[model samples]
Target: MGTLFRRKSRMVVVDFLPLPPVESKRLNKAISETGFCSRREADRFIEAGQVRVNGAVAGLGVKVTPDDKIEVNGEMISKEVPKIYLAFHKPVGITCTTDTSKKDNIIDYINFPERIFPIGRLDKPSEGLIFMTNDGDIVNKILRAGNNHEKEYIVNVNRKITQAFIRQMSNGVPILDTVTKKCRVERINDFTFRIILTQGLNRQIRRMCKHLGYEVTRLKRMRIMNISLGKLKPGQYRHFSPKELQEINQLLANSIKTEEASEN
Candidate 1:
């Protein structure tokens, strides 16, 4: 009886020693940050028996520590490096997509070291400057629906443009279920015009001209925000200079500050 009691006491004392705390976040956060899915969707994947930890099926509420192995859909997930930003003068007929299946996708046209995506879209049929970046955060800042970043385009119409049409365009023509925002329009020649817009509504220029009973013969974007196409010819690209980058960063900072102030 004494020996049994001593052994039991020893066991109890050993059990009282501290154990490591379980990590709070697990597979869900990893999967979500990898852009595989949202947190809620990750949880569903766990519950559905689609996730694995160390090659074993994982269930919801599974605790994942730093050393634990994790996989989703039979693929391993690893941390990615910081994203890169780039600028390219997209020529006509090149689709602004990464998909290789498309005959003339942007990826095939520009041979860059990193995988980048356009901040916003430039239609395949149109030609001009386009911003490309892998940094998703900047994409939101530049392309947010409410952002008023000026985009300038040189447009050539099929027919002679009259002063009345220019007045109507500047005065705000109705299109896309809303009155077009006030914009800057200048007649450069008999059929050529320079337009600066604060809002991007799909093929806005094309739609606007169509509404005014004019056909756009050629359209080319010359500027976005503070960056200009400059002397860049079609199908050319270059890195932003330090000053250019600083300017863009400043613009984004100011825009964010303005938005926050308005909410308050």
Candidate 2:
């Protein structure tokens, strides 16, 4: 009996020994790990008193362990949520913004079951293929202008075919306080042309056409990097195929992902 009692005592003492510290990360990071939102959005929730850790309001920069419960706006955030990636065919007039207050916002239009944001934006007046994902890390890597990812567009201008116009566009055009980079521009028809650009400036194709004395009648993006619209009609969306996802991951393997510093 004494031997058994001693063994129990030893077990109790072992249990009392200090445990290795539980890994903890910033509150915003913990929330973002669930794929619920980006770190910036998480910080906003913290500042707005919409985030709670273990039933207490969370503060900015607070560290949380994996075992801690995290809730946003009274909804418990689960880290097991699946990451979503989509290629959407944006229709003209749909704004590429997350603000629900704004009419015709892309988020409202898609009504995705899981919260997601566009990787980059397409102009409201122009439309075509755009990427949407819940993985915030991938968004930065894909959107970074320096990454040199290709975005292809088919543009219709109000003019007759001119060899000089194609030559000038392919060479480069001055716009947005800087000369645009040389890109591949090919004439498709009398007034239609295809352009693949590595840099995304504000309304780049439109501005380039206007600079050359042409007005864009229609602008539609056809592809982004390796993904093409591929029969997805306007306002339609499709999940990224496994092969596409694999290729994209391979492409971004060496790409850099960055986050803006938030004051909150």
Candidate 3:
């Protein structure tokens, strides 16, 4: 037989009996891991006394185990909920923001039943495939520019493309006070081209074009990593097939989730 006694900040086991390991984690992380909300939001809920664990109000820094009963706003939260992953074809003029008050925000436009946010954003003037997911961890994994995940785009410019332009773009163009990384740029026609980038500099494509004295008349993302836009029309979305999700997980297996790690 074994008994537990409180000794300062530690629990003492009498009789030196062995006990099964109780995997534990911070309460906020537990909630986030369940895909219910973000860790920040979980902290807010705890501070506001809206979160309870085992029928007692939870506090910040609380540690919880898988067996803990967690609740929020008088509703019990399951320890595990099916994760949602989506590929959305964003439309031009739609802002990729979660703020419902913002007009033309992607969240409101999609009107999904559950909370999901865009992995990364496209400019309001551009349109194409973007990822949406309740899995917050995967966002940083895939978005870390240093990971060298490929994002392919089709672009149309206001003027005819030239050989020099293609060479310059492929070699690397100076943008955002830094030189853009060398990438694969193929001329599709006099006015259109295909580009694949592993960098995510702000307005990179447009700025690169402007620096070369060309204006981007149209831009559309065609693929992200191993996922493709396929036939999804603007403002439409589809869940990732099991095979796609499996492949993405494999690709991100070694990805770092920190911004600092992504900086050159």
Candidate 4:
């Protein structure tokens, strides 16, 4: 397990590349793997002529070695440390932010021995399975539910559940500036229901409830894709198992995070 992390500082070193190396890192892949940005973003930057290698404009197909000086928008892109992926069951009232100044920020609450940040938000009033990772690039890949990843939630409403509400929620609810995509909503009890959403809108579920004239008394995320919030109490976390990580990698294998999907 010690091999997974380096005892030295978080700063990583880039080794010198051998001359005429058999293989070199592709510009987009190198930038994405460095956790600087998504590969989609890297490609866009290259297209916009914002990327440079050895002080020359780098195209999309350009390759880089350790000897190459890669820059974006005039700032050099450097090597990155290894990434960490964590699953956390956050308690209500903990803010999902990296800003340590926030009194109840999730970062300060978890206080992992190393630097890490929550992948997506669970909101201050809600709780449950939220991913914490040091890889910024993977954030878009996971959160872009347009790729068909599912996020399940259990909600308790202020009023008794109704078939009409379930049908409407399952069909779709018009909120914000656009209608929400169709999702699975089923009743669990008089005032409780389970919902699986494929789109992450800003305060989506809450807004949908308000529009239906129902108030959410409690909300808890049960799962994100294949990862479950099982046996995890509030303010608790665990490293993803090998099986879990393997399945996730398979799921994200062909998924590329684009700007359009990230807006969701």
Which candidate number maximizes TM-score? 2
TM-score for every candidate vs. truth?
0.71, 0.83, 0.81, 0.74
How does candidate 2 score on lDDT? 0.84
lDDT of 4 by residue, 139-213 (tens): 777877668789999999999989999999998889988898999999999999999988888788999999999
Lowest lDDT block of 10, candidate 2: 255-264
Q: Show where candidate 1 strays beyond 4 Å.
A: 1-82, 254-264
lDDT of 3 by residue, 143-195 (tens): 77889999999999999999999999999999878998999999999999999
Reference-based lDDT, each prediction: 0.75, 0.84, 0.87, 0.83
Q: Which of candidates 2 and 3 reaches a greater TM-score?
A: 2
RMSD of each: 8.3, 5.2, 6.7, 12.2
lDDT of 2 by residue, 96-197 (tens): 888899999999999998888887788888889999888766876776667777888899999985999999999999987999889999999998999998
Stretches of model 4 off by over 4 angstroms after superposition: 1-18, 21-80, 259-264
Q: Write the per-residue lDDT of candidate 1 for residues 1-264, one digit (tens) a residue.
A: 122235644743233446788665667765554544445557888888889988999987776766677788898755353545566888988887766688998877886765566666788778888987655446557765477888899999999999998998888888879887899999999999999987777788888899999998888999989999988888898888788899999888845311110000
- Global lDDT of model 4: 0.83
Runs in model 3 lying further than 4 Å from the true structure: 1-17, 38-63, 67-78, 260-264
Judged by lDDT, which candidate is best?
Answer: 3
